[model samples]
Target: MAQNPERRAALVDAAIDVLAREGARGLTFRAVDTQAGVPTGTASNYFANREDLLDQAGRRVYTRLAPDPASVAHALETPPSRELVRHFMHDIVRRVTADRTGYLALLELRLEATRRPDLRRTLTARLQPEYEESIRFHLAAGLPGDRSTVSVLYFAMLGLIVEHLTVPEVIAADPIEALIDAIVDRVVPRE
Candidate 1:
């Protein structure tokens, strides 16, 4: 409802932190305002309701977690190959790990979505296109994968990220990079 972009962005970002730290049940407008260090009701001013805040937080997490353009360009500069796929996978792990809060907030949003149909639809709409694009990019870039390969790799990496972030002890046996290499090797054929 507020027209100030900076304040709105700050509120959304604060909402993300609140979600990650307190889960959906604790994500109140007051919590976000306190997290943002703004006056009380500031978040409510920016967001029409809890649902609006949740939706914006979901979108903000993705925006925060998206790869930098420079990295994308660097990846594209290298010839498409299994090694490149490995590089991409490694980057994914690194980025998510580096932004643990964002990923955790995203996980929280995912759980909340189960109870909110509108959120489920919003997340599905946002994520499905990216999933499809991964497949398209793998094919168009001539990466060593088909749709199934990309799908499996996507799922495997997602599982690994969840484990690494939520219950790291489960994967403490091996270095994450080593595990990433194994996943890429198994899914993407050698050139």
Candidate 2:
């Protein structure tokens, strides 16, 4: 495998784009190289096989989608209230929607994971900590909800996002921000 970190990261990013555009079955070293604008076999040198490429793409998507540290810190500065929770949820939707390709790549990873047990385990392992941390943050920040609230909000936002991204016309009449506010209103208790 190549030792150049920047080049490797670029390949993984390109792989993510390929996965989003082509799905798992269409991901290939040649396709990745073409996407990355690198010479043929460049991706092969960085990744051992298709699985390795897919795994790296999955990891990269999370990295790309993670909330900005500055934004998180700023959110923390505000008193944790139902309104704050709404803001955070809105931020999540905004971030995901802004990075459409990354989210799409993540969706591809989820679909691919369904067919591969190893991938399912890998994705579960990767996401479990983040999920737990969200719960912890909600409690620690004095947000007006418990684990169950956060869990429901997570699923609800995920469904909303999937619909907004994949078939937006289905929900075209409803504003996404309003839907998010409604979800937070229902899930988190008022002060």
Clashing pairs in 2: none
lDDT of 2: 0.91
In candidate 1, what residue range of length 10 has the lowest lDDT sum? 1-10
What is every candidate's alpha-carbon RMSD to the true fold? Answer: 1.0, 1.0
Residue 115, candidate 2: how far off, in angstroms?
A: 0.7
> How good is model 1 by TM-score?
0.97
Question: lDDT (CA) for every model shown?
Answer: 0.93, 0.91
Residue range 113-163, candidate 2, lDDT tens digits: 999998999999988988899889888899897889989988898899999
lDDT of 2 at 25: 91
Q: Where does model 2 exceed 4 Å of error?
A: none
